[model samples]
Target: MSNEDQYGGGVGSGYGEVGGTGQTRTRLPDAPSDPYGTPRRAPRASRGLVTVVGVVVLLIAAIAFANQSSDSPRTPADQTPPAATSTSATGTRPVDGKNGAIPKGFAHDEQGAQSAAANYAVALVSADILKPQMRRQIVRQVFVADKVSELEARLDQAYGKTFLDQAGLDANGNAAQGLTYISRTVPVGTKAAKNSESTTTVDVWCTGVFGTAGVGSTNPVSNDWFTMTLTLRWAENDWKVESFAQKDGPAPVHTDRTASTAEEIAKAATEFGGFTYAR
Candidate 1:
C-alpha cells in the first residue's frame, strides 16, 4: 500500500594491537566503552541506513501497483450504462399478411402499434374507401368491433354520392372514361407517444398521391403530406386500431421537377409496390 545493506565487520576491540607483537595495548584517551564493551553506538548509523532502504522499497512497490491498476481493463461497475435508443430501427419485422387488402394482426408492443397505425393511415386514405363495397370491407378490417358501427356511419356520410359525383366517380365509385383515380399513402415514419398493455397512441407521417392519373383527366395526380394519429387497443392477441385522426403536415418544401405524363404516372403507380413499415 501505499531492503538493506549490512556493514560487514562488527565493532571489534577499541584497543590497538602493538605492531609486530601479539600484545593489545589501550591507548590514552581511548574511544568510549561500556563495562560489557558492547558496540551499540557504531551500529546506529547502519540501522538508520537499513530503515531508509526499506521505506524506499515500499514506496516503489506502491507506485508499481497503481500503474498496473490504471492499465488493466475496467469492470462493469466502472462504466456508465447506455441509454435506450427509442427512435432507432427496432429490427422486428412488420406484419406479413393483409386482411384482403388492409393490413391486419400487428404485434402486441410499441413497434406493433406503430405498424398498425401506419398501415391504417394508408388504408383510410386509399381510393377504395370511396366505394361503398370496398369502404365497408376497410372499416371491418381496420377498426375494432366496438368502433365499426359508429365509424361506418360517419365514413358513409363523409364519402357520400354527392362527393363521389363531384370527383368524377359514379355512384358505384368507378372513375370516368380514360381516367384512373389514384389515392395512395406512403408512411414516412411512425412514433408512439403513449403505450401500455391495453392502449397505445401512435402517429404516422405520410405522403400521399391523390386525384386521377390518365389522359383527359380533370383531377390530375398530386401529392400532399400529413400526419395521422391513431389510438390502438390490444385485442385478439394483436394490435387493432380503435380511433384515428389526421392533420396537415410536417411537409417538405416542393421541388421544381417536371411532372410526369399521365400515362407514365399511371404506369409507375401500377409497377411500384408499397412497403410493410417497421419502427
Candidate 2:
C-alpha cells in the first residue's frame, strides 16, 4: 500500500477538551462540640496523631514491598503454565503436520504460540509462493482443509497478471533478467488476543521488503509494516490457521542505513535465500 493509503486521514472534533460548568457549595457549620463538654481534655490528640503516622509508615512499606515483588523477574516455576509457554499461553495444543512443510503440532504454550505465529507469517508472505506449484503446497500446508480451496482461488486472483507485471515479473511469475523479486516478512513481535486450550488468536507485527530490485526496473524494493492477525484452531494435535487478516503498521522510526544501488540490492536478493522463521 502507498504511504497515503497507510496514514492519511482527518482529525476529529473529539480531540478538543470538553468545557465544565462552575458550581460552588457552602460549607456546613461545624458540629457543636461534644455535649458532654465537661472539659474533655482534648481527647489526647497526640496519641491519635502517632497512630496515623504509624499507619502511614506501614502503608508506605507495604507499597514498596509490592513494587519490588512486581519488578522481580518470574522464573518458569513461578509462572503459571499458560503464561510460561506461548502454546499454553495461547491455550492451543500443537497439531501434527498432515505432511511435511505444514505445521502439524504447536505447543500449547506462550513460546510455541509465538513461534507458530512468526513462522506462519513468514510463509504467508514469502516469495516462494509466487511459483505455481509451491503456492499450492503452501496453501495446503498452512490452511485447514475447508479453507484451502477458497484461499488458493483468492490468492491466485489477487496476484493476477496486472499485479505481476507491476511487480516486474513475467506472466508465469518469474522476475525479468537482471531483476530480483523480493517478498519477505519478518515478525517483530506476537501478541495474543485470546488464548485457550484449543484455540489461539494472535497478531504478528511485521516489517518487510517487496517489489523488484534492478537497474531501470519500474518497481524498486520498499519497506512496509503490517500486522497479520491469525486465528488458529487446534486439530490433529497441532495448530492451523482458521482465518487471517492484515492491517498496516505499528511502524517504527526509519533507520539511517544508506540505500544501496539497484545492482547491489539485486545481487543480495539473488545471493541470500530466505529463511523459515521461528520466534
Candidate 3:
C-alpha cells in the first residue's frame, strides 16, 4: 500500500482539498455604458482574495502564538546549579515522553555539540540533500573522515533507482508534474544517552512526513517515526554526526481532522518550505 493508504494521507494534515459551499451571482447594472464606458467601474474583491488574506492573518497569529508559548530565553531552569538530588553536572535535560528516545546536549558544555547533531540529522534526511551532488557535499562537511566514503556510497545506493521509482520520481529524483516530493525529519526532542568530557552519545528521536502528494500520485505523504543515534567527538567547536541509524515508530494517537484533497496537499507542500532545526 502507498504511504497515504497506510497513514491516511498527507503530513500533519491529510490529503484532499477542503470543500465548502459559497453562493455565486451575476449583478446587472441599471443601464448600458456610453462609448467612453463611464470610466470602467472597479470590480469587487474576489472571494478567493478574501480567503487568501484570511489565511495569511491566521498564519501570522499562529506563529505569534507559538513563539509566545516557547520557553523563556533566559537560562533554562535545569541550567541552574544542580541540587543534592541531581546526578549530572549539566542540568539541561530532556523531558520524558517528549521524543521516543533519550535527549541530547545535557552537559552545558555539549549544547553546541547536541545542536550540531540535531541540525546534521535534519540535513541528512531532508529532501534537499537527496540529490547526489548535494548529498556528497553535505556528507563531506558534516561527517568525520573515516565514515565519509562509506556513508556516501551507502546513501547513493539507498537513494538509487529503485527508491526513486518507489517515490514516483525519475532516477534524478525530480517529482513528476503536479506532484510534490516530501522527505523531512523534525526532531521531536534530543537527549544525552551517554556522555563524557570527550565523547557524547545523543539520541534524536524524530517524527516526519515523507513521500509524494499529488493527483494520481502513487506515493502519497505519510507519517514516519525514527530515532537517530549520534556519537559526537567534540570537533572544531561543533558536534558533528559521527554516525546515525533509523528505527521506526512509537507513533502517537491520531487526530480527527478531515483529509484534504491530493491537490491541496500538493499545493501546500510546494508553497511551504521546511526548517533547519537547532538545539
Best by lDDT: 1
Candidates in order have lDDT scores of 0.48, 0.43, 0.40
Best by TM-score: 1
Positional deviation of 197 in candidate 2, in angstroms? Answer: 1.9
Q: In model 1, what are the clashing residue pairs, if there are any? A: none
Tens-place lDDT per residue, model 3, 66-116, is 111111111212445645533323344422221112123323355655655
Q: Is candidate 2 or candidate 3 better by TM-score?
A: 2
TM per candidate: 0.68, 0.62, 0.59
Off by over 4 Å in 1: 1-84
Q: Flag clash pairs in model 3.
A: 15-260, 16-260, 16-261, 17-260, 17-261, 103-190, 103-191, 103-192, 104-190, 104-191
Residue range with the least summed lDDT across 10 consecutive positions in model 3: 20-29
Clashes of 3: 10
Distance from true location, Cα of 10 in model 3, Å: 17
Residue by residue across 153-181, what tens digits does model 2's lDDT show?
64454344643443345666678877776
Better of 1 and 3 by lDDT: 1
